[model samples]
Every structure is written in C-alpha cells, then in structure tokens.
Target: MPNHLVPIAFELPHITLRGLTNNLTHKPLIVALHGWLDNAASFIPLLTEVTDYHIIALDWAGHGLSDHRPPGTDYQQFDYIDDLHQLLTEQKWENVILMGHSMGGILSSIYAATFPEMVRAVVSIDAMGPITTESSVAENLRTGVLSRHQRRAKRSIASPVPLTQLIDKRQQHTELSGELVELLIKRATRPVIVEAGDGGTQVVWRTDSRLRNASLIRLTEQQAQELMTELSCPMQIIIADDGLLAKRGLWQQREQWFGSAEIVHLTGGHHLHMYNTEQIWAPIAAFLHNIST
Candidate 1:
C-alpha cells in the first residue's frame, strides 16, 4: 500500500505562502528539498527506503503548487533561501537532518551555515554553496524581471509544452519508470496561461528554465568555508559523476568550504539519483543508516 502523506497546507497564520508537509513521526525528522524547477514530489521514489525518517518535502514558490511570483519578480537565489529561513524560524524543529538537491542543495548549505544550531546533518546532492558563477546569470538578468524594469519578451518560454510534451522531454534525458513518471507529472506542474493564437486561455509551464540574472550574492572561497565552520554534526555531500556543477571546481571548493565533511560521488546526472532511485538509493541509504545510528 502506498503511504499517503497527509494533505494539509502547512501555513503560518500570518504568512500568505505555505508548504506541503508530511509527518513521518515514527522516524527521525528529515527535511528534503527538491531541485530547481521541481517540486516536493521529486522525493517520492526515495521515500520507501527512507522510512526511518519523517521527511518534509517542499514545493518552492512558482514550481509545484506554491504561489507564483508577482509579475516581473526575480526568482532570486536569496529569495529561495529566505523562504526556507521563514520555515525554520517559525517551526520548532531542532537538529533535524537536512537534504536538498541542485538549487535546493545550495539553499540547504546556506541555511545550515546561517543556523548551525538547528541542523543535525546536511546532504547536498550535486551542489556546494551558492551559485554565483553561472554564465547564464548575466543573460537572465538582462531579460529577467528581477533587475531589469522592462518585461523581457521571449518568443516561447513553453513552446509546445503540453503535459505530454514535458513527459517526452523528461524521457529523452533519463529512463524513468511509469510510476515515477506519474508522480513527477502530479507534482511538477500547473496550468499556465498560454496565448494559443485563439486569444483564449491555455495552461502551460511558467518555464522549465533556470534564472539568467547574474546572482548578486557571489560566494568567495572564504565565505564558503565560513558556511560550515560552526556545524557540530556529521556532513555528507553527494556529488553526481555527470553533473557539470560537480565538475566545475565545485567539489574542491565545497570541500574547502565544508571542512571535514564526508564526500561521496555517485553515478547519474544532476537529477540522476531522484530519477533512478533503485540504483542510487544504496549509498544514500547507507549514509543515512550510518549517521542515524
């Protein structure tokens, strides 16, 4: 039988935004975060193996079921971290294990560093620290809403992006099982406003793309080190063998930043572990088992 996570908008009474929370109370508390352009459901495949922990996965704003940004809003890196900060500040979770992937990984790194006392451990999948060196940064900012006042026009953020089309796209990159695909389809998207020439409204993705703006919050080597300087718990960094971010001096920089942290490189692309949990779950499970004990 599928374990159904309770459906409730984990909302702070004073806050307009909310997160989807699941309580695995019998297990250790774990906060799992998905990658960029993905949602809470991304962790579904690994959910079975991680029965020891109560995992709280999140749908970051504008990705899954969360709220979209105001027109011309920059999906700034800092904004993502701030939302997490809000969650941590309002909740009473203490020393919970933290796991995040891609952009989520970077956000987790920042959160653990800033609030060392609250984290028990951290698992960063294929990323280390903040992303300030991406070439796309300047390009996105030029056309993106965060910095530029003008609405940068694009021909097609979602060209032919029917749900069918997105599934096809995901298929081309990785081999996914039917059940996994269904779960991803459920959590990864919402209907978007599309001008399909009839002038009527059509639903599509906001864009399955990352930000192009040059990140204002650049990280130097020292700042990276400072992020992990105060952590008193075990640290685990999971790097993907094929992920470009892992190859681009990130592992080295991340190692320097997170002094004394355990590093493990696994096979797959950036979302490899999430897509194919059968193969990738072993190391992750072993790590969690070793640490939780």
Candidate 2:
C-alpha cells in the first residue's frame, strides 16, 4: 500500500513533538507511542491495518526529530506524562485511544489512570504500567541523584557514522529483520557533514544521548498498583512469549493490576510489534473496534 502518513510537528513551550499522522479527519484519535530508543516509525506497520481512525505516532521528547530536553535536566519518566497532557490539551482531544510499546506502553497506562475520563481505551504491547523498584527509598534517591549528575557531567555529542554501520551495530543487539532495521534507521537518523578524508557526510542516529541515562526514579510496587487500579478504560496488553515481562515473571502480577484488561501472548521478542506486525495488529484492531461500538 502507498504510504499515506504525513510528517507533523507539535510545538510546545518546552519541546516539540515529532510524529506522523494518517486520516486526520477520522474520529476517536489514535495515538501510538514508540518504545525506548525507538521512534514514531515503529507504528508504520499498523497503518496498513488501522485505516478507519485517525492515527498519530509520536517520537517522545528526545527521540527522532523531536527536540531534546534542556541541558542539565535529566529525562524523567513523569515528564512524558506532562508532555502527553500538553499535546492532548493543545489538540483538544478527549477519550483518546492510546497504543504504546515498551516504555510508551507503561506511560500510556499511567496517563489513562491519571486522567481516566480522557482515555477511551489502551493497547499496551510488551509492557504494563510502571516497573516498581524493590530498593529502599533512601538508596533509590541516592543512586538517582548520583547517576543523573554523572550522566550530565559526562554527556558528549554522538559522532556520525555511515548508515550501513549503524544498522549493523543495532542488529547485533536485537533480532530485528533487515527491513525493520532499515526503516528505523531512516526514521532515527539524519545526514551530517564530516570533516574527514574527503569532507564527506554521513548519517547518525538523531536521538539525544541523554536519553541513554537511567531513569531518575521508579514507581514503587504500591504506587504502580494504585495507578493500575485507577484506570477506568478498557485495556488490552499483548506480551511476547519470550519477552521481558515473561522472563521477569511480571505478566501475571501486572495483569492483576488492571480492573478491566485482557492479556494475550504472542511469539516474538520484546519488539514483537515491529517484527510480527500482523499478529499484533489483529488484537489491537479488535480492541479498538469493540470499544468504539
């Protein structure tokens, strides 16, 4: 199918949200949020299946073409919730259908709970709510402060490299197919002029280096439970059979947190949505259809 997606930028006071949208005139706006270190292009596969509703896939604050956070500021998980709130308010959106992957999925669930009346439904892929920390409060706070300072003080600009090398490097870490890797490279990189041999230019990942820093803090088990219990919309969570949730024994506990949620298991790794798009799309489409009618 021909690509019908349009690149869009949502300007905010602090940072701009970069994303792609399709069929903007449609109702019940569907917003897709990508996983950590990923960009809006992660949702391109769904465009072929989810044609009935308007869709917007965002690149969060520091990913893709979006602006990075101000210097000296750490990337906090809650900051995403604030950004989403601003985006929805600016667009005058209500009862939105949110679909998120990995970190995005966690954020979407938190947002739905925080403002239950604003979300119609939620589709979480390979994650559910926030991951709670078992560390003591004092220890957690101390570690967070030290880590943030160390990361900020040592931050440096990323050197540009050939696109082919970038793809090869990423492939070593994940089982993503060549096609998907190429797609991500296209969305997450830009050409840069080099002062080398022939003064040639190369493409580099456009993500902010600060995004690699560890989260400043994490929700406690009690906090995560509270957020999950507060969710008022229909929810669907898809976990890959070999995914992180399964490995860490979190699926059962996470599933119990939601009052109204259905859980399904698919066959793939953490990024099942990118590699097994068709399988992932079926459940998502069904959830959206059921909620809309």
Candidate 3:
C-alpha cells in the first residue's frame, strides 16, 4: 500500500515550520525540500513512489503554513540553510539524504557542503548549485535594496480570489500543468473572511511578499565553486530536459566538484517529479540502491 502523508510541524526558536511526511520512521529518512513559492504538498506525487524511505517535505518559512519571519526582517537566501540546520539538530537526525527541487536543490547542495557528516547523499532535481553573479558588489547591493523597498511600498491587502484563478495565475509563471499547479496552490493559500458579516470566505495566498524581493547578496562564481569542493557525499542530480539547467554542458562543468556524483537526464519540465514521478523515481531508486550496497 502507498503510504499516507501525515501533517507535521517543527518548533524552532523564532518560527514554526510545517510539513507532511509519509510516516514510515522504520526506514531511512529523506527530508525533502520544495522550490521557491512552493510548499510541502509539492512532494505528494513522489511520496506515492518513494515508500522505501521515511520522507518529510517541509514548507519553507513564509511559504506554506510555516510562520513568516519576525517583523522587520526580510527573507534572505542563506538563512534557509540555518533553518534546515536547526530543524535537523532539534530532531537529532543524522546521515540522512536530502531531496530538493529548484531553489530547494540549491540549498541542499550548500547545506551538504557545510555539514557533510549529516547528509549521506543528496538528490538535486533540475538544479546543480547556487546561482552566481559577476556584478560589482556596489551594484548588486543597490539593486537588492531598491527591490525590497519597491516591494514594501507595493504591499497591500490582496482581494480574495477563486481557487481556479489562483492556479491559473501560478501556471502562467511556470511550465507545470494545471493539475500539478493546483496541488501546490492549495497548500499555499488559506481562506479569509472577505465580507464583514455575510459568513463568506475567499482564498488568499499565505506566502510572504518578501520572498519575491531580489536577494541582498549572492555568491560569486569563484565562491560557489569553492563551496562545492567541500561536498564529499554521493550525489545524484536529475536534470529535466526542459528545466533551468537543461543547457548542455552545464552539469559537466560542475561534475568535478563532488567526491561522487552522477547525472540523470529525464524528459519533462522543471517540476518533472510531480507529473513524471515514475520516470523521475527510477533513477532515484537506483541511486539509493547503489548507496545501500
């Protein structure tokens, strides 16, 4: 029987993070991470095929039911690594595998590099490493600060919208099919009382607006390469034929950074694991088999 997803939450010092798990604790654990704007439900498809491992897919802070950052604080790229560290340390989990998609995949690589002993392997889907920049520090800083200010100035109460409309809007930004988009959007939104006394509620996004702001800083290309060199665990990178890292020769260039890594190319869009679970899971299953032996 396919495992059922159980709702779970982690209480950290500053915020509470929520997630869904397959609840198979007897098996080895795989803590899954979703991409930008997506929540834990993004892994629902994979949970059906990945019954061999105990999987917990988290809703990054401000993305799903997780608490947004404290007042006056904006979201930063590197702070996610710290959040993951706190959750793992509190749970006392060790030597586990990390499965991440897109932004999540980037974080997995950096986290594994930072603390290689905690991660037994890493499964990165459609992402090889962190995006790097060649722009001058002054220029990057200025752009990021301006972007945050613009977002803050534009913030306002969003009008309640229909569920179908939310899915339509999200699909416009990605190649994911409507069904796939709906799965994620459902978890990322909540119902709010839109009428003063009519007992009527309408849906509104729960994701923090600060997430759309430009990153305050990014690793330079040299800095990104240096961090990759610290990674020593076996890594499996599943590249989608039409995904962001689909450009030929990209993965090959970064191949040398890992102690042991292999690339598997599958046919699909960026969120292939959701719509193409069978094809995506085969290589991942094989990868895990190879690791166990």
- Top-scoring candidate (TM-score): 3
lDDT string for model 1 (19-89, tens) is 34456678777888887766777776676555556777877767666666665455777787677767776
Give the number of the best model, judged by lDDT.
3
The best-first sequence of candidates by lDDT reads 3, 2, 1
Error of 2 at 106 (Å): 0.3
List per-prediction Cα lDDT, in the order shown: 0.66, 0.84, 0.88
Once fitted onto the true fold, the runs of candidate 2 whose alpha carbons sit more than 4 angstroms away are 193-201
Model 1: residue 250 alpha-carbon error in angstroms: 2.7
- Ordered from best to worst TM-score, the candidate numbers read 3, 2, 1
Per-candidate TM-score against the hidden true structure: 0.77, 0.92, 0.93
Q: List the residue pairs that clash in candidate 3.
A: none
Colliding residue pairs in candidate 1? 137-212, 137-213, 137-214, 140-212, 141-213, 192-204
Candidate 3 lDDT over residue span 155-265, tens digit each: 898878777777888899888889888888878888775555544446888999889888889889889999998988899999999887876556767767654788898
Q: What is the clash count for each candidate, in the order shown?
A: 6, 0, 0
TM-score of 3: 0.93
lDDT of 2 at 273: 86
Model 2 lDDT per residue over 101-197, tens place? 9999999999998988889888999898897898988888888887778877886777778777777788888878877887787778888865565
